[model samples]
Target: MGEVGWNEWLSMMSSLAVVLVLLGATLFGLKKMGLSRTKDATKNLNVSEVHNLGPRQKLIVITINNEQVLLGVTPQAINRLGNWPEQEAVDDLNQSIDINQLEPDFESPSDSPGKFQQLMSQVAKRTAERKKH
Candidate 1:
């Protein structure tokens, strides 16, 4: 085998560093660009919300308790939130309700938040505030 030269080692290292830097830059650029194409949820979007988010955007529908709740913006509304307490509560609730027993032909939103429900809730909350005054 030929003698290993210091210049060759430096050259190899320099090329590797450049490649790594380029890869990192590309990855960073991609991440910064927001590759997640999923549109913001629709259930909770109000007229004002739409105005704030700009017009003509796709929205996702979410059902909570058989009721449809429109989560506002894409980045604003999260599907899976990190909540340890909620997880535990869900596990406990699961233990109480047996899935096999409550067989149903169709699934509906029982507690889902509809547009009216949101309005009503807001009104009720405002009423309570007025009462406190």
Candidate 2:
């Protein structure tokens, strides 16, 4: 194969430079138009927590526009499980009794079932109550 000449090298470099300039300009234009992801655009929406239920299922808590929303996510669908106002969520967090305290006691096998049932019932009750308001 023939060696590349100086002119060929120069032509290749110039073409590369032109392509880089175009790419940069496009990115800059997109940012100016607010088409690119920016803090301001996402300030009102945030994922607060995520819990994996199974290999293909998860529970996600997100805060949007001052409301907290619980979502059930599966491979095929996303469902809204519950919603609460931000103030209520804050009050719950500030309470002396933590929700984790109500979780099943892993150390005592016999206590686990009853505690788990209590926790599930409380969650169901809370969801139902929130739906009414």
After superposition of all CA atoms, the RMSD between model 2 and the true structure is 8.3
Question: Distance (Å) between predicted and true CA of 43, model 2?
Answer: 3.6
89-125: candidate 1 lDDT, tens digit per residue? 3333233322234333333423333432343334334
Best by TM-score: 2
lDDT score for residue 76 of model 2: 55
Residue 43 miss distance in model 1 (angstroms): 12
TM-score per model over all chains: 0.31, 0.48
1-133, model 2: which lDDT tens digit per residue? 9999999999999999999999999999998887865447458888987766446555677999999987766555576767889888776534323345445444542343344344445555665655465
